[model samples]
Target: MLKSFDNKALEELNDSNASENERAKKGLKKRSDFGYAVLFLGPSLLLLGVFVFYPMIKTLYMSLFLTNNFGQTTIFVGLKNYTSLLTSASFLASLSSTFIYVIGVMVLTIVLGLALAVFANQKLKGIQFFRTIFSSTMGVSVSVAAIFFLFVFNPTTGLLNQMAGLLHLPQLNWMTDPNLAMITVIVSTVWMNLGFTFLVLFGALQAVPRSLYDAADIEGASKSYQLFKITIPMISPSLFFVGIVTLIGAFKSFGLIDLMTAGGPNNATNLLVYRIYQDAFLNGNYSQASTESIVLTIIIAVMTIIQFKVLEKRVNY
Candidate 1:
């Protein structure tokens, strides 16, 4: 009996030691993996901290104080900039125009992009050429697009005005006129961003299995029915993604607006992003600009959250 107890105790002790050794090995492996992860991610984290996070923090910090022409904060003004801007007519107009521009860009870009993607997806001859042309705008930089649109929208030599003259129609201003400036900007911005949206939707359409369409066809479903019921649901996730991306892009639009309109013709095209630039550089209101930047960031964040909450429910995946 004593010998049996001794054997049982020895076996239990050995089993305990084995389990401990296994745990020790697992612990060492976890540490080693963590070390490797830190090594791999350190550079990216450092870069983000220095370039993105630090600037964001600095901008928020600067928004709380009054800054001189050099953007050097001097007085500790708590929320005065925010209150003043929130009540300013210029700020209100810019905010309204910003929403209009963003919504216009977001809606038109998605619709036109999807239309182009569908056209390019057809298996007709010379389809590859059309696809290339459809996606070619993706390679065009903002500076190039803006410069090209400048001459295109000019009142005299502009293609639209020339066409109007040829047709003996009324001559109309494209960029200089306040009524048409925002529309022209929206059109150009849509054209510039369409290629990216087209590419994403096209890729998504390609990934959708043809079997679904085949099944629908065998059931005597019409083409439009198939498109709405079959194609859209399959690509809903991509559509959701493109919507958010284009929304954000529209909100942050600056270079093209700066080059084209300069928020001209009685502040009609004065988007919030351009307003921020005008405040800081043109008007030399750095502290208020910083506050505007913070407000813009918050608006974007809230909009993004709303999109995710609302649109994500319809996403197939």
Candidate 2:
């Protein structure tokens, strides 16, 4: 009887497996299943091809030629435009400024965002209000923030100098002084980006299981120790996301530099994006501008690759 029962159970399992296989085969025959997918993805692919891919290819092709002041390609200069950019003083200065701006924004935004996220994650009354206030900076557009900072950092009638004067501190140039212009821009960019970073990290922090914290507490781990070991590792994915986004935003910053300094005080704040604008729009050096843009794109791509390679090792899956 036991042998008969075992054979019956095996037969039932085989029947179930056969049914599943039959269903899977029927599903494979359903070509209409992917129709909705293609329908959904078709528009996006078309848009990307038209806008992003086509422009990228055009820019690369345009970079090979020297353009006249009217933005027309006047000569087939080959790689001379790129070589000139490498050797140009203003281009070099802008490249240096770009690195500085990107790094400053990345470091400041991540550090401040993490700190704020940690604080905002606390179980306290009216915490939502604090979170909202902290993330409010994201609402301010780059142009608006630049305009606001323009007044804030004004030497005579500005809030910064006024406050310094009230405090009996010596007034210093903010945007006018070459040394401080990039720093001022960095500050503004960091502030503008902090809100999104904070929001991402805060959400990541909330997703961390409370049981992990409890376990850490039971292990007698200090808050700092727990934070470093558990919190950071767990939220590393979010941190990585914020880092990449901030880096890209910093590299593409145009409005702040345009409004605040206009690459002023002798091109002190002329970041790569602004320099590209200067070349393409202001100087009408379309070929050279395209070259600079390509260089900028390469730099961003290399840096992003480096970030993935270096940071991925430390990131907890």
Candidate 3:
């Protein structure tokens, strides 16, 4: 009876394997069938081709030409526009301003977000309330935030100046002053980005194991020591992710600059993205704009690569 049962079980296992092999063979035969894939992916591919690839290719092509106000290409310049932009004082200034804005925003957002997340992660009463408050700005639209800051940063008749007057402090121009304009915009951007960064870091903090902290405590580690040795290492992945995102967002910022400064006060806050916009629309220099666009894209790509190369090794996971 035992022998018969063993043989029967082996036969059943063989039958199951045979059925699976047949099904796999059928699946292999059907692999060439792309009807469903085309049905699903055709629309997305078409959209990408029309909207993304075509524009990108056109921009590259246009960058090699001299375009008129009527969007007509007059001559093939073959990187002359790029050379001119590279040698131009205004373009260089815009590039410098872009770096300042991107770096400042990235640093401030990551530091403040991590600080707030650590604070919120502590066990205390009303912690949830503070977390909600810190994350509230995530819901604010970019236009609305820019408008709100416009009022706040107004040199005269603004809340900041009014408060300064109450304390008899000297009123400083926020938007009009070349020295202060870029700083003002950077601060506003940092604030606008804070909510999302804070939320991400906050979640990352929660996911860190309490056992690690307990172990550190048992080892008589100081809070600061634990923070540097353990907490930061654990959350470094989140920090890196947020840093990359903030870097890109800073590079692409346009709305706040448009609303508040409009690259005013001698082009003090004229970042690369806004410069591109101005060249294309306001000045009707499409070729130059496209050249700057390409440059901007390359700059962003390089920065992203550098960040990944340098920062990825530090991330714990």
Which residue pairs show backbone clashes in model 3? none
Off by over 4 Å in 2: 1-24, 27-43, 303-314
Q: What lDDT does each candidate get? A: 0.86, 0.85, 0.86
Using all chains and alpha carbons, the TM-scores for the candidates as numbered come to 0.86, 0.84, 0.87
- Candidate 1: lDDT of 98? 89
Runs of candidate 3 with Cα error greater than 4 angstroms are 1-30, 304-314
Ranked by TM-score from best down, the candidates are 3, 1, 2
How do the residues 217-261 of candidate 3 rate in per-residue lDDT, one tens digit apiece? 999999999888878888887787788879888998999899889
- The candidate, 1 or 2, that scores higher on lDDT is 1
Model 1: per-residue Cα lDDT at residue 227: 83
Off by over 4 Å in 1: 1-28, 32-39, 304-314
